[model samples]
Target: MTARSSSAHVAEVEGVRVDTRHWIGGRRVASDATFTDVSPIDEQSIADVHAGGQAEVDAAVTAAREAFGTWAAMPVKQRADILRAVADGVDARRDDLAMVETRDNGSLLRSHLRGVMPRVAMNFRYFADLAEQISHPIDEIRGHRQRVSYDPAGVVAVITPWNAPLMLATWRIGPALAAGNTVVLKPPEWAPLTASLLADIANDAGLPAGVFNVVQGSGARAGAPLTRHPGINRLSFTGSVPTAGVIAEAAAKNIVPLSFELGGKSALLVLDDADLDLAVTLAVEQFDNAGQVCLGAFRVLVHESLHDEFLQRVLASASALVQGDPRDEATDVSALVSRPHFERVRGFVERALADGARAVLGGGPNDDLGGLYFRPTILVDARPGSEILTEEVFGPVLTVQTFATEEEGIALANDTRFGLAATLVTGDPERAERVSARLNAGTVWVNCFFVRDLGAPFGGNGKSGIGREGGAWSFDFYCDVKNTVFAPHGWHAVEGGGDS
Candidate 1:
């Protein structure tokens, strides 16, 4: 690694060059205190990243505040054009971004290249077009006409998680920038490099200085200050419930508006009429990304008639998942993000096993593969409302429970505190609609897992999240909606300049 004062600090990792510095006011800012970023694949040091503190947060927030007026005042079409250009930049460097994220976060390279990377570009493009096309109709009440408009909220602070760094960050950033709000993003410390790369892309796409700034470091140092800063007009965060609580407190201090997508213990209900193959596949999908996903179906409730068959098929599919090097194209799964995270996940399963839950498939680490790789685990016989059954383990461990009746199934699925997402595998359309409406989840999928459309509102119902984000909903959060009322035809203003 080499530090250049006038430019970004550059480092070479596995034949790829990456910028590792805080991006503020269209400049790369470095600090004397740095943290070593390690790759989860082999536990090797990848790069030295600048550890941001109050000073960096102050600089980023100040930049965003200064840029907010001009950015917000600019024509929406012009802003959309810039967003489209950023999308193009992301598309042009898709392969590189995928590779970097894979190494940084230990997610499969194939997933990033095929799914995550493309969706990242799509987020910008989708928001750009929506920003231009979305319109609010004028309303008439009594003798007055009112035109509702959304004005950009000044300085938005976007704090994202490491599970799906680039994609999730852009999910918030695209809409924020499209709404004409300048943003100061505090990327997760575990997978911060891709965010730096994104800043570079934004700058190259001609995003004006101070419009999009990044401050990279630990939550206590960078995130806390950014959340609590008075300059921040709006905030969005995606992480654990405990972390969200901390952020909620910080936001409350300044009364900064916040949108959160927090933890989930989402359930996948296997109805008696469901296709056994499809139900099995959906159950196995929970192990994708090593079960780090907040929307993952960690709790599986199966109808008694299909329980035996579903369990058998799910085990076979999970066992077939290839766990190895994340860089390999054929690899389906990889190591957890870090040693601490691995330990945390491992501890969850250990405690469950001790509590008498039966692990028919996997119970602990996959020693044969070694190094932070945990086997896809399936637990059963856990008592109702037990720790493993109710809490979010956030690992490759899933528990299977049986429900004898339709009412029982719905009750079991809605039992968790989290309502981020749920999946119902059923062939009957009427039953799908009936059961889906009753399930307490923000998103309900019928015979599908993780199918998302940018136009639809996305969020949680309970502890899963605070507010929705997507399409106009995103605009609503990033902007202050105001209605301008007009005097009816032939109406006259008062002599004091007040409307009659």
Candidate 2:
């Protein structure tokens, strides 16, 4: 894929060259405070992003509110057609968007171009088709017919994370729009470029002004305001648990319904009868995207009978992974999003080692790369209660534990505060089914990992999240259901008149 020329689209604000800006009310807008975008690969300046705050958040929410009525009034087919056009627009700009995201978030260009971008467009199309099939269901009772219809939830605030900016943002935006809701999206400050580009694409696809808006800045400044804004009818946030708590409190003030997809320390279980090679492959591959994925298998629980063998294979596979610049197509792992994140991940490994956990593979930073690079680390003999095993590292570090019985494995996997996702690898289909039924996670993959169906519900339980997302779940979250009861024209109401 060819990289788009970024210089040609540079914007000038007050005689200063700016590469990023906010999209509010269908146009690019600048902000008084600016944040520099630095590439994680080399720590070089990539652009100056607009640092939007309360004022900008207010403007965005106001715009979405103003456009909600008109957007919600649009016919379903027309809305579907517009969503298809948006999907087409994203497909056309796939390469450019992939490059922007890779530069902004340190994702491998190959994966972004092949996996993330296509999935982004697919999400819009999926919701579009679902929207076309929606209908109001009616139930008839004694002298009345109740028609249950869905309506847009008015203005929605979508706060997305940096890990997979565009993909996750569209996960909220597509369904919200398809359900006739106007949206104000706040992309994490660490990766905001593609979100602005998405705003441009929506405008080109004929999305009405104020129907969709993008605000770029820190979570405390932009995201907090969006959550608290009274104009917003619903909130959908994907981030850490602490942040979700803060948002939950703010949304409660106005009784705004919310969908929270919070943090996870998901486990990948390798049963005694499982195919060891496939299990190792799946475990090591969890480090894809530098383990920033929320569903990543950070904790691996292997049957004691297979633990030693699995550990050797895991160590070898992880050691063979190539870590270099993200732009390098062959690179398996890229730098963390920033230096602070890198230090945090390194600290996890350092503390784990100091606590008597053995580093079976990588345990240090790659200083030679001159960037925020942490080696793909694997830890064994980590105490089950240790921070590395219990908390979310959110980096390319996998902690291994051993379980003697199938019951113990299941218990170990479900011991975390998060129940976002889990994986079970086993040759016995009966065991897979039985153990999957016992797992507390929202999604349990049997003999595989990251296998998703766009039509199925996706979310978490426990501290991981509040409600489901994806397909019909998205529609439900962004919409309000109203029941309209119509009584027979000449009917008279009487207490206890109806006969069973």
TM-score of predicted model 2? 0.95
Candidate 1 lDDT tens digits, 1-500: 22223334776655557788899999999887888788788877778899999999999999999998899899999999999999999999998898888888899989998899999999999999999997867987566787989889899999999999999999999999999999999988888888998999999999999999999999988888888898899999999899989999989989999999997898999988999999988888888998899999989999999988888888888888988888888887788999999999888888888988999988898898888899889999997888998888878889999999999999999998889999999999999999999999999999998989999999999999999999899999999999887887777973234544
TM-score (all chains, Cα) for each model: 0.96, 0.95
The true-versus-predicted C-alpha distance at residue 26 of model 1, in Å, is 0.8
Give the worst 10-residue stretch by lDDT in candidate 1.
Answer: 1-10
Best by lDDT: 1
lDDT for predicted candidate 1 compared with the true structure: 0.89
The residue ranges of model 1 lying beyond 4 angstroms of the native Cα positions read: 1-8, 494-500
| Candidate 2 structure quality by residue, lDDT tens digits, 370-483 | 569888888889976889988899999998999999989999999998999999999998988899999999998888888888889999999999999877777788999888
